[model samples]
Target chain A: MGVGTGNTVLKVDGVTKTFGGLRALDDLNLTIEEGTVHAIIGPNGAGKSTMLNVCIGQLKPDTGTVTFDGEVITGKQPFEINQAGVSRVFQTPAIFEDLSVLQNVMIPAIAHRDGKFKLNPFSILEKQDDIEGRAVEILERLRLTELMDKHAGSMSRGNKRRLELAMCLVQQPRLLLLDEPTAGMSRHDTNRTIDILKQIKEGGMTKVIIEHDMHVVFSVADRISVLARGHIIAEGTPDEIKGNPVVQEAYLGGSVE
Target chain B: MKKFFANQWLVMLVFSAVILTMPIWLSPIGAGYPDLLQKFMIFGIFAIGFNILFGLTGYLSFGHAAFLGVGSYAAVWSFKLLTMNVLPAIIFAIIVAGLFSVVIGYISLRRSGIYFSILTLAFAQMSYNLAYSVLTPVTNGETGLQLERADPRIIDSLFVEPTEGLPLTNFFSLSLSGYEGFYFCAAFLIIGFFISLRIFRSPFGLKLRAIKSNQTRMQYTGFSTKPYLLSAFVISGMYAGLAGGLMAATDPLAGAERMQWTASGEVVLMTILGGVGTLIGPLLGVGIIKYFENIFSAINENVLMAAYSGLPEGLQHFLVTVSSPFVGEGWHLTLGLMFMLVVIFLPGGIMEGFDRIKRLLMKPFSRNKDAVESAEEGH
Candidate 1:
């Protein structure tokens, strides 16, 4: 069911993206309501990551327009889209390897507050009290305050993934796009991440997640979209998608749980 | 412990002490000359600036010498046209070089990695060719730009009458020559080092490091890296320009050859040799290369022979012959060998070497502390 308040957050309309002869996204159309978690689950070649990339302006779509909060964001730069209150946690956990966890988290918050380019070349980092406070608060919320000074590169994969999430969350974006948040984590880590996702859900920031883990998918997603061959095969609640034979045959391997 | 080492004032104190006492300390190594020490300060400024761009952002610009050359030209022009007041010359040089870098950096930063390096290298070569050939009216071409008694010093003439001979570049009555010029240049070097230290600790500097660490993450994090990159480029250009300004202030000559790619490569070598992205490592590199350039290059066959005269007659002659190539005309060979060894053994440069030694020295103290802590735990 939709939000019923009729508040549409991200609208992907007639979006077609192609790689030579192969269509990665074949005129895919989808709508995400405000304050909801929409999970896109699909097979390997179903273009889930490609869809997220197009939405985030990392890849330009061929014959369609993707609008965010009614702003045409199809051709905008990634940083521009990001500045417009959209944050994405990369699939492979992109982070500033040379910096500490605190710096990794602080960068996004500074960018968000200071806009695309602020020439504060002389302003000391430690002197930015507000930014430091916000960054510290977010790291604390993510239970990463203990490891704040550890190098981002040296962090374990799960912790790095969490740090990436903290980076995204620090911006307090209107829309958060996560690509496979729990992809390579242990079940214990996966469960902890699910708790985090659920915790953020209470804050009412709309989330568009592309996930493969069925457990993570069902645990946090408010709604589900089953994508197959660059198109949505079915769209409904997690329970409804679990019972959908088309999704079961295509992605769920004829059974879920 | 890290905080104590990172204390900015303490670092600055040590830096000033070492730089100010260079004449006394470097005397033992036969490099205490004011001229040689001035070269150290000037190149130290250049290397520190180069480190800001290359060290922080990982943008290996091979055209920095163009900015230095531009600074030299601007400074000399100021001496000829405006004033020989080293203050105006330095300021004018910085402004000109900064604008020059803005143009070059804007275009070069459009590409990244080796392409950026190539673009910068090409721009420098273009600048050199222009100055050496086409821009003869301004640069004086191959003969180089020099001050003549006939030329007007408009600002200097306002306060004092023209002299029989070309007067020295001065601050009020004090001539900027010999140790005076070295101290003048050293003052700029200290100020430049302070600016660099601030940049390294500043959020802006951290952002540049982020660009080096992960460009994709920076872009996605909503940082438009071009402004940050261009600012670094321009700042380093100004620093190179400052070095050039000091050079002309002391000698009042500008040559197109200063923009050669070899000169640009020298700064890169200095930065890497000392330690890229370090506060004092670039200065250490400058000290090493300039020391070799001045001292090692002066050691002739006669000097080597005299030093080894205490040895056996045959062995003395043999030792002099063996060590001769690495000195005088072959000083560059020693520099090359040293660079190679550093690159292979100490990739982090002299700073890493210092760190290793410090750790080695601290081992005994740490072991005692560890033993004491373990005994207390057992109790």
Candidate 2:
């Protein structure tokens, strides 16, 4: 809304969620404009993951509704929400460990194309050239082509992150949600990941990233939102967020480096 | 891709040839009898269907025998009320078993892991008790349901006169008994094996494997896994049903004992002992267990001593005495020891053992790096 003229892809309204006596999300509202990389940065225990969970339908918001593409999607199943063109990458890579890396990427594309359910037990997987081509393309883009035949579980942490990202990208999702995509990765790997993130931005897929790494945040994020006590403390372009007094006091605890 | 289909066709031909020639090749080992060969084919179908569910999806269903039992009852009822034709009986059996599985799988699938197993087990036990007592009119209870000369065969009698003796289940005019019966079951097994292969290589099968690997990942990947699982459950149940129908087709009898938990356990043992996930492992497991059940259980001290007569008298007697207990009336002991060994050492069953032996033999010719790599490919 501040800079982009694109339509809103996701909107959270008065979302409140509680665990026991503690509120994880307290009347928080946010909007993600189309084709913009939005970063949500927070200190520990600031309900960053809880907000993502609610958006992806992993957890139900107790009070408010979630709107995606102008349709209310509250209380929908995770798969249904995903089928509606939202894909997620976990903090820890959630790739299918037993399956080959190619399959990990191919599965989401198949789901994306085939809808929620299809009973094609007799159709050969090898014959699905379109899906396979998409998977291979995504893998090559993420530099995962060499590891396509390897089991997903056997990949290094960085490679698995790339693999998980490949899995999401293969779906051509309208919106991508990544939770600490470089969490445990080396600095070299993190830099390569930021490059990969930049490469995919041209596809016009809106992204909401929950990151602790300031370098990743500033490099890929177009707009930054600082979260504290389950609500947005500040929202602006990265440079504005860096200079904002409230965001510095609440999240950074000092001026941005 | 064409090469894959070519390989599949080659596998089909070789399987058919082997199954068709079982009588010639197995005669030396004394398992060539029609009755025993028929059991092999029937149970081979059972395990092949089972692997589709347990092997691919990783749903350990302990109540499969209930489907088998239900199929038998349905087949016999079909023979009594509808027709004496084998096709109708088998179809009825499959349909009924499919319906039964939907109910059982629907309830049992609500929970997972050991709870899923316990739920299936409970449903099967309840089914057995009902068939044995309250549903005695349908199941025939203690005596079992058998073809009766007095019972109606509406479809068959409409076309031809009823014979005075008890009617035989037949395909058209061809009687399904003796060698013909074995051949009938073998045909079905071959067809079932081919279908199983198709399922193993298909996209649906990939989804099932994904579910088995990590269901949460599958869900987040935009798949509703319930329908896939239920379809697999019903499909496997129909397989057990077909096996049961074949049983009644070959020998015109339906017994409540077929529904017993022990019977379910036998199929599980057959699947695990052969290689749970391998295409042809369950058949080997079935052949071995069925061969032992028939051959080993028939061995007495006299039979043992006669076989060992070439040895010295004292040694022959000692061998007979020592082996007799594990043979006749104690064949389970031998099976138990084999199961134990397979579980402890060959955890992937007989197929894994074969894989290792094949690798070891090839290790000398190939580089160590390639040998290790190829070994990992199958895993």
> Against the true structure, whose lDDT is highest?
1
lDDT of 1: 0.92
How many clashes in each structure? 0, 0
Q: Which stretches of candidate 1 lie over 4 Å from their true place?
A: A1-6, A255-257, B364-379
Q: What is the C-alpha lDDT profile of model 2 across A105-216, one tens digit per residue?
A: 8888899889889998888889899999999999888888878999899989889889989989988899999999999999999999999999888888899999999999
Residue A213 lDDT in candidate 2:
91
Candidate 2 chain B has its poorest 10 consecutive residues by lDDT at B1-10
CAPRI docking class of candidate 2: high
Candidate 2 chain A lDDT trough over 10 residues, lowest sum: A248-257
Candidate 2: which pairs clash?
A: none
Q: Write the per-residue lDDT of candidate 1 for residues A121-229, one digit (tens) a residue.
A: 7788888999999999999988999889999999899999999999999999989999999989999999999999999987779999999899899889989998888
> What DockQ does candidate 1 have relative to the true complex?
0.81
How many residue pairs in model 2 have overlapping backbones?
0
